[model samples]
Target chain A: MQDREKAFIRALVRSNATFGIGDDGVEISNFVVANDAFFEDVHFKRAWGSLESIVEKCFVVNLSDIYAMNAIPRFCLLMLTLPTDFKEVGKLAKIIGNCALKHKVKIIGGDTIAGDKLHFSLTFLGQRQKSRILTRQSIKKGDILGYMNPSSVLTHTKTQAFGKNTKILKTALRFHQHRKIQSNTRFAKPILYPKMLLELNSIARAGMDISDGIFMELPRLSHLNRLGFKVFKPKGDWLYAPEEYQMLYAIPKNKLKKMQNFAKKHRHSFVPFAKAVRGKYRESKKNWHT
Target chain B: MQDREKAFIRALVRSNATFGIGDDGVEISNFVVANDAFFEDVHFKRAWGSLESIVEKCFVVNLSDIYAMNAIPRFCLLMLTLPTDFKEVGKLAKIIGNCALKHKVKIIGGDTIAGDKLHFSLTFLGQRQKSRILTRQSIKKGDILGYMNPSSVLTHTKTQAFGKNTKILKTALRFHQHRKIQSNTRFAKPILYPKMLLELNSIARAGMDISDGIFMELPRLSHLNRLGFKVFKPKGDWLYAPEEYQMLYAIPKNKLKKMQNFAKKHRHSFVPFAKAVRGKYRESKKNWHT
Candidate 1:
């Protein structure tokens, strides 16, 4: 399936499209269009989460793609296929409506049908200033690469604290005592701040959201730009773990200080991890002492 | 599921979107966004058709929505979920690519995943000239309602003739001798001619493609406009049967001659079936002697 996915992407590249398959979304003139699918067993197990949490996660997953391109998500169309036994139709609508309200995106139109299993797909429409749109193919040698560390977004202890303090998280906390299950709700939620991306858009040369782990995404960036990546520290399992909603980006070496200042002003932790070089694609296995 | 589908659509209507839930697509600025879903066992059986036909049908289904609005479909994004046994991934891409090429619509970006069943969802992005876009809510009393009859698109004998002559349909002809099976491929295809719509766009008040039967859709239009439809002839099974790619439109009574001339110039069959009047929604049960 992975190889076929690549082949499918390569076929589309010949169409002279503005963005490649690995990019968060494709840019058409001023509009950015993208879609994401969430299946029952592949993406979520009905026993692992509530219906509301699953629906909310679906919207956040699609939004992550739009935000990765430094674009503002304006509208969404949903396609849902439900099993015959599923009867929470009105509740599902309310949850989706609430999510759209929170993000200020309108639910324009969609199709609904009955099927064997539950399937949720959302297509998001967004826009970015012509000068601010980002792509992964623009990286150059000597550029500094950075990533939004999963630990920086929310650690297990912080999630537990938030679950104990907030009323919404309090309900999720009662489901299990283990840290993994307790933090599941927070993990499903996406931390999106489009304003921060807009602020760094001028300095960032290339960017993509890390939905398929850092190792998988780094190779894509390297392959697209025909350059190699040299990570500073890469000994931890976190480097290879699949983390959703985190962003990986490349910045010019000369703009590192400005990038750091912008992150500090926005209270975001942008960790620099690698540098692009003229060589075959390879990752550092040892930790750096910088 | 039908009740829930209605509930979900009603919930979205509260957002004050540019178009209603029953319309083919929603108008956002000058572009229209729409989506449709096709499930494996529900919409098609793998043993009954080829992969190329299924993929082509998916594209045509989405295209119908764009054309119903008198809009030009410019771009598409696909989200596919396949079972583990499905291995026609590359062939699927080639067929979709060819369809997009034929329609001049670009394949932008999409997501793919493995699931319990084969699911295909297509999202279309289209543009409409400011003065040309039409919507169902714009219908008025005394407007003449017209439809592209299923027989006009392709009849059973015509489909068999096409199947016998075209190399592509020869493979489909081997499946079953039933006229239903012979006409299935043609039914899956969409008849989109934007030039004809452009000619009628200045005068057509409201329009929609009929995926659900005419009997079901006519009431929706009447309910939306707070009017009734008086059908002249409605006894044929085609009137109550669900047709995939036919369109139903409302043209001003004064513009009937121009609409007829445009349809003839474009080599299209536009059949007048009903008229808008001040009353509750109802359908004629008897056939008319035209």
Candidate 2:
């Protein structure tokens, strides 16, 4: 987050003394509520993907927040701002409806309006699972920090492809046989292991989804837990790739082998790249939000 | 709602077989979930009111939905889009925080991002009161349709004032002593009688907030209840005025005396302008959404 945004949120947290603002979602009675905004140009370019893919990505990202809290998404409220010239309203609605059906979430209520840009803000209400809600504030000093990296080359290439020119992807999608790229891009279909994350809830001391990359999230974990991270030779994209949607977790040092076994059974490469240490940690100012 | 928007929502309703999409808010368990968007220019022009008042109106409008459903708003998630050059971040946070505090609503979780225009999408979760939840589908034939019109000339003037050029209001607010206008306008501070509405829940067979005017909302009630409205000599603005934030209710015809007595005790004029009849009702295409 930028400095101004941080200051604004700080003011809000200070003013609302009882606000639990640090978690992915707030727990109220047995329900976890979360919201996220996916605006055109800011979150995605129209030329980069189809509307179906864009809508799917919006759902995936918001649902990730719910899963990170160890809750099952049960209902959603969508606020859509459609452009004036935008047609194909039926297609848009079907995509959303189908997404909700596939996820077993009820389409409760929301508002739709016409505007100059296409913007979507989704609010999801999730029910807690059998285990306790996982949060970023429960890490211990001896916890081992690891992430469930789904072993897929297509996913890696898709994340890398986002930094390239959108014009090339647009042209390729229009003319070339790029069905694989169209279907496999992370922006269109983000990889999320909900079952794995939910099962790991028993062992995860602290956890959150990697939306703004691990480098950006580590400091938050550090600040919340009052400890620094001792890196185990962290490399390249693992540190700075935003919107990974992977689960970053702090596990008990003794439960590392059990967590690894669970991850291995799920075809996920569990990378324990850091350990919680007793020190202050500071991070670079760069982030997905500008 | 416009034809396209209607069609879009119809498609959504059809696709999601179990969706309960007609009410002002959706009831899940004991909570009512509602969402609304207050986009810049679309909902209100910045030149028309102060940022603090603008923010306050946003809260009132969303909370009105909760109250109309016979529930008390307990939590909210805000999705804010801040313009690039926008300042006064601290002031905005304080206003939001204070509004949440005033309504006894917790600021649970939300997302904030920088964009080209100021937009806010608020999702409110309200806890149901002792009375059963009021919805639009329960109005029966011969039920009296009434609205709680707070006896205030300033509110009427404010609704009419929106029709005039905004430049006049802008210039007046800038140079003249318009403190009254600054704080009293419906756009700045909408009038909502939550206590009165909640108390009347026992008698209201059906109810909803008059968001897009009585004319626009009548058809919705008509369609939902499978009955037509017998409007009794509807006057000018009462038919077409939007964003009144007043509760439009369906009361049993025999309970008119009790409803009137309740309104009189609360110092509100309960205007019974219509009755439910057996037929069809159609509305003009013009609405706030366009």
Candidate 3:
């Protein structure tokens, strides 16, 4: 780093403000709750992404986990790795605070480190009702798989970052500009729907958000119970490309209809994708997504 | 990535194992963690610093955080960027796991990504006591500053990479290598002292372990509480030299003498750094590692 940059960083460190860039790492507490997001470049970018959208995107990424577990996020630890002279630190922080307020989450303890690329990882601690908790390993075979939020966040980014150096900022801007020109923007609504997950009660059987390659997540969850899954994902391009934060739940076949009703009540897209099976992938049909 | 390397990645992914590296990115869960480390080339050369020591060094650097937070760390996430695969990753992972088990921690999650230089990071998480949380913001002025482990983790890695690199592997078998090395090896012990923290119950006003620079952290904790810190960090290079981990707490002055009793019980060190001040840097203290 040049002398000037070093000086800038030192000032950021000495700002005596909430958070800043520092060579000396964070002064954190113990028995703490934190979460970090290792965002793929296209998942968040600044160029055209409105500061609010970028901020909103970050909240969506993390709260997805909180929702999947049917928990209420109490505090968040935001760890950011961005380029020197990070263009939007202050704005992003503000947006995060606002979103947290909307969701009743607090920005308690976290750090911001400098990296060559933009990787925003936020660790959040949620308050679960002890026994009312859910985990991937607890999933059972033959449980009906009830999926929600048909237009997952994955579909959004895949469309925006189909090629080139796609990043969070560019993808966000793509949505923003599209909304501005069309004079209609429903992005925020879908993004906020995950917050309703806390009300899922006990219906969300073995559950997980469609992060990573959803294709990969399915078989992995099934394996936890030595079972296979027969998924009937929507037969469209949307099934393949997604930024959609789709919730994959393993409810029993008898409860699938009830779960769909719950989704309609909350107005989330409830799409039944697969059924938990009792065989290996080789023995089952593999023609889906192909 | 060539075809074979791509296949290697595919197989790692197909295993449905956590922490695989691919286009889909790392897939470790919340129970998993990884951290990053950026070091000066002169900081540790391959000649004097055995690959085992480097591996141990990286583990201490991050494992310290896991212990500091009073979390039961189950795994370690590693990403080391070096000129070549000069170090055996399996050996590194095993050594880290051994260290974790010694400390009652675990090595359940990790992701390794190559980089242009010898920069590495680990993002790991541990289970913290859900309650009895600690944070830097809780420190008020006039609190006692205590040192759990006053030592530093400094070693010579200067002649290694520049000289007969990794020649230690070819040297006549060293007899001492078989001895059970101390977990408190000067370079590793400073960071692994979780026992001291377990003693810090309800008394600590504000605290954070010194990893960056203790002097740097004093001001940080001060800033976090919107207060000023008065610290007597020794008067020389000790302030800037990289420290593995050292406790820096501001407890109530009334508890100052209690630390001595605690010290006797634990054989720990107690350093009476300056009082928690209410203003900016003192004019007389310009040697603040600035």
Q: Which candidate is the best by DockQ?
A: 2
Candidate 2 error regions (>4 Å): A153-183, B153-183
- Give each prediction's DockQ, rounded to 2 decimals: 0.39, 0.65, 0.04
Candidate 1 lDDT over residue span B21-91, tens digit each? 66778887678888888777666556655676667777777887887787889888888875667777666
- Candidate 3 lDDT over A1-290, as tens digits, reads 12222232233223222121110111122112224344433343344345566666677756776666666565554445545555554545455556777777655433344556555555555666544555564556677665565333433332322111123323455564344221112232225455456655477666766544355455556555677777676544334433445566777678777777887677555667677778754222222110
**What is each predicted model's overall lDDT from 0 to 1?**
0.68, 0.79, 0.47
TM-score of chain B of 1: 0.82
Candidate 2 pairs with clashing backbones: none
Top lDDT: which candidate number?
Answer: 2
C-alpha DockQ for predicted model 2: 0.65
Off by over 4 Å in 1: A11-20, A150-156, A159-180, A184-186, A282-290, B12-20, B150-180, B183-185, B188-190, B282-290
Per-residue lDDT of model 1, residues A1-290, tens digit only: 25555666666566454234667688766767788888775665565566767777788778878877878888888888867788776667777777788887877777877776678888888877767777777898999988654343444344422212233233333443333233343455546657776777667898887665566677768878999988886545446544346667799999888888887677666778889998767543321100
Write candidate 2's Cα lDDT for A193-244 as tens digits: 7788888877888889888878888888888889999888546666776777
For residues B22-109, write the lDDT of model 3, one tens digit per residue: 1011112233233434332323334434555665666665666655544446543333333333345444445545554565543322
Flag the better candidate by lDDT, 1 or 3.
1
| Native-to-model Cα distance after best TM-score fit, residue A249 in candidate 2, in Å | 0.8
Worst 10-residue lDDT window for candidate 3 chain A reads A18-27
- Best of the candidates, TM-score: 2
